[model samples]
Target chain A: MSRSTPLREVHETLGATLTDFAGWLMPLRYGSESAEHNAVRTAAGLFDLSHMGEIFVTGPQAGEALDHALVGNLSELVPGRARYTMICATGGGVLDDLIVYRLGSEEFLVVANASNYERVAAELTARGEGFQAEVDDRSDQYALIAVQGPRSQEILSSLTDADLAGLKYYAGLPGTVAGVQALIARTGYTGEDGFELFVAAADAVSLWQELAKAGDGYGLRPAGLSARDTLRLEAGMPLYGNELNAGLTPFDAGLGRVVRFDKPGDFVGRAALAPLKDVPPRRRLTGLVARGRRVPRHGYPVVLLTDGTVVGEVTSGAPSQSLGKPIAMAYVDTNLSEGLAVDIRGSHEPVDVVDLPFYRRSK
Target chain B: MSSIPEELSYTKEHEWVAGLDDGLTVTVGITAYAADSLGDVVYVQLPEVGGTIEAGDAVGEVESTKSVSDIYAPVTGEVVEVNQTVVDDPSLVNSDPYGEGWLFRVRIEGTPEDLLTSEEYVTVTSSEA
Candidate 1:
């Protein structure tokens, strides 16, 4: 049986299409996914992210334990700040990408992908055995809601006096929202100005209702996983299974900047990843825009239009509402730039190599 | 529940067939339930107008935002016409699946394979739902 989040009833009430994703019955969309996508771009959209894993690490060696376990230097992260990092296997392949938030001097929250949270939590425990820190999986205790878009800050400001203006990107603080305690983080995946509120699971329903009531006049629609996927795709963000996998390192996925080798101690994949930092990868993650209407989807081959030689493969793709065309992220041969096409189904559809992000919100 | 027109026949694949009694050509399109399940239709590929197809043959495809499905032929016949409007603007499938979103018309050669009535199609969809 798929576990339902606290907002399942609310989603059902709103006539959402629910699907089993990562062992959780999550809302795929409330109505038209395109409308939901457009709402996030033009106004605001709410998201139920309770399926994400929240693993807490604390103690004197909390930061040190994370530094040795993951790629980034967590010990250097100041309190109330967050950093995107990755956990790699011993062979330097990406295990999972993560966000580490330093809540206090010793408390840190590690947010991980829903599908890999159990494995990630177990790995964090095993990796921190010799250290003085403790790992606790608190995923079931939290429900995360995100308000994203151009009008997100405006809508959220009406609910709480949490110093929304003072909050910087990648920073989080404990505060009260709608009479419930929440960790309001000025961060999101939609490539827009937004906030992600992490609250107790018990308070999820009330907080969602409060936010909905407060956002009624601002055009904040409840978005789902479908819009989230397309929004992140347009923002050039990588999905774990689609982009980063057990076989590809961060460098191969064009996210090597997250791997910090200058940290104090030796990390898990340091020895394997250090040698690969300077060496160029054979296939680099790139973006492709379809010249035709047919969408090039995941696992499709990126081939040369002239000779039909397979050079790379698509990881994630969608009909982008922002670009008004089909866009995809693929790992292409670093030596080749132009004259590319994706073998969509059986036909090779022409594509142009574009920059990573297909859409960027203007500040 | 998605509307199932009482006068139409449906295939187990979620396609609706109309004009079977007219004896010349029958219109085919996916049911509203199928279109709703597909979310937003982005692309529609229809078979050639002059092509011959057997019943149950996968003639073309309907690509949506999240996934794609094959459009199967419901009856053995020659493809007489295809919906150019649907091909141009696939969102019609979601907005009006039975009318403007009609996929194609086939000149029936013989009796179509056993298809469900509106009531029977409701049962099939309800069971799946």
Candidate 2:
């Protein structure tokens, strides 16, 4: 039997097309993908991200333990703030990328990919057991709802009495939303100004309804995993399985900035990061724009036009929501010169090998 | 909630072929159901104009961020013209698939067999997820 999320009934009522994603039934589209995609860019859209995993680490040594477990520096994170970090293996390979939330000085919440929940939990438990922290898998107890877009604050403010304006990007607050207590974080995968709400599983249905009623005027629509994937891709955000995996490292995935080398304590992969810092990666992930609309897709062999040698492969691609062009992200030889062409199928096209965060919002 | 128009005939592989008054040429494209199944269509590798193809042969391909699907030829024919507009904007296939988003026109060299009629196609689609 297929697993249904808490909001599955709500999605069905809204005429959404459902598909099984990662062993869970997920809505693929609610309305036209173009309209739903535009809604997140121009207005607002809510998403049932209940399938996303949430883990909690609490005890006396939670802070120090987390600092030693992930590559990111977390000592500066005060209560109610979140940090995106990647856990590394002994050889500096990425175990999983996750978001660490500082719920308190001794309490931390880690949100991980759905498919990697148990693996993350197991890793966390094994690593954290040596410390005074207790790692608990809290995914079943909590549900995630993402209300994303430009008018997200305005729509979400009507449901809760908390000060929405004060929640800066990546900052969160433990507050009440739609009469249910939630951890409302101002961070999301979509490249939009939005909020991610974590509420009790039992309260999920009621809150989804209340928010739907309050957000009607803001052109608020319920988006599905389909729009979410395209939105993240257009933003040039990395999906764990697609852009990151056990074979990749934070440095290799263009996430060197998040790695904390100067921190006092020795983390899991601290000894290995020093060597990788100076050496360029074997394959660097970069973006590409195809000629016409024939965009290259994942696993599609991307070759160098000069020698016809297969240099890399496309990892993710889509018609960019922000740029209004077909764009793709690919992993190519790290030493491959800055400027080159990608073999999109048999046809070759020039591509700009540039820095990431391809889509930037107008500040 | 997406509706496949009754005027066009559809293939189980999701391509819809529409007969025209000019000749045996039929305009072909992925149906609305197919477009929805593939999410956002970022690219289309269209069959070259004047190229010949056999029925059930690989004429071209369409790709989204997550899926790559073959654009199967419904009938054996010579590719007459490809839609340049949809080539420049493949999302048109997702927005208005039945109308402005037609893929290409094929000059049919032989008659199509076992092609599902409008009503038959509807029944087939209605039973599908």
Candidate 3:
């Protein structure tokens, strides 16, 4: 049986198609997914991200514990800010990608993927055993709502006096939204600017209703996981199960910059990742745009157009609403660049090797 | 619930057949239930005009945003004509699956077998849903 989010009733009333995602019943879409995707690009869209796990770490040694348990210099992260980091196995294989928010001097919120949060919480508890920090999984007690897109700031301003303009990217602050206490974070997975409000589970429905009312004229639609996938793909962001896995390190995914070898103390994957830093990886994550309408999907073999020799594999793919073509992220051989084709089903569809970000939001 | 026309014949695969009584030629398209399940139609590959196809043969494909489904030939026949408008604008499949979204016209070689009546198709969709 799948767990239901606090906003499950509201989603049902909106006639959303609910599906089981990561052991939780989540909305796949309310209506046309393409329209929702377009709304996020042109106007704004609301997302129920309560399925994301929020693991709280507190005490005097919270920063130290995180620095040792995961990669990145979390101890140096300023309060009220967030860092996109990852936890890895001893062999440098990624356990999960995380966003750590520094709530205060001794408090930090580690947002994890739903599927891996329980294991991540256990890992953090075990890793912080010698330190003076405590790890608690508060995922079930919180509900997260995100308003993302061009007009997100305007829509969010109508309901909260949280100084939306002063809140820089990757920053969070405690504020009251629609008379409900929330941790208003200016962070989102979508490529556009947005605000993620973390509130108590009981206040979710009313907050969502207020936000929806405020965004009525701004063309805010209730977007689901389908649109979220396409939007993130176009932004060239990595999904944990698709891009990051236990078999590959950060360097293999072309995200070696996120690993801070210079940070003090020996992290979980420090030794294994240190040696691989200077050495070029065999397969580098690359982007591909389809020449034809056929989409290059996940697990599809990327082969050489010349002799059909397999060179790489697609990790994530979708028909891009922004690019108006099929786009994909694949880990291809570092030595090969051009003359690539993704073997889609029985036919090999030609593709061009492009830069990592298939689309970038204009500033 | 999706609309199932009483005048049309339906296949278990969620395809509807029309013009069955108007000579040997019949029009075929996916049902609205199938279209809603597909989310948004991005591309449509239709069987070639004048091409020979057999019943249950996978002749074309409909690609959606998240998944792809095969368009099976409903009746063993020669493809008389393909809908060029739907081929150019695949959104027609989601916007008008029963009307302008008709996939192809087939001149039947033999009577289509195992087709369900409107009432029977309703039961099939209800069970699946």
DockQ of candidate 2, scored on C-alphas against the true complex (2 decimals): 0.51
The predicted structure with the larger DockQ, 1 or 2, is: 1
Report the error of model 3 at residue A207, Å: 0.6
Report the Cα lDDT for candidate 1.
0.95
The TM-score of candidate 2 is: 0.91
lDDT of 3 by residue, B1-129 (tens): 888999999999989999998789999999999999999999999999989999999999999999999998888999999999999999999999999999999999877898889999999999987
Candidate 3 Cα errors over 4 Å, as ranges: none
TM-score of chain A of 2: 0.95
Going through the candidates in order, what is the number of backbone clashes in each?
0, 0, 0
User: How far off is residue A283 in model 3, in Å?
Assistant: 0.9
Q: Please provide, for model 1 over B75-103, each residue's C-alpha lDDT reduced to its tens digit, 9 standing for 90 to 100.
A: 99999999999999999999999999999
Q: Residue A12, candidate 2: how far off, in angstroms? A: 1.2
lDDT of 1 at A21: 97
Candidate 3 lDDT over residue span A1-363, tens digit each = 999999999999999989899999999999999999999999999999999999999999999999999988999999999999999999999999999999999999999999999999999999998999999999999999999999999999999888999999999999999999999999998899999999999999999999999999999999999999999999999999999999999999888998999888989999899999999999989999999999999999999998999999999999999998999999999998899999999798999999979889999
Candidate 1 has a DockQ of 0.91
lDDT of 2 by residue, A49-142 (tens): 9988899999988887788888887767888899999888878888888898898888888999888888888988887767899999999898
Cand 1, B chain, TM:
0.98
Query: For model 2, how does the per-residue alpha-carbon lDDT over B1-129 read when each residue is reduced to its tens digit?
Result: 567787787788888889844569899999887887787777788999999988898888888755779999988889999999998888899989998999999899867876777788777778885
Residue B36, candidate 2: alpha-carbon lDDT: 77
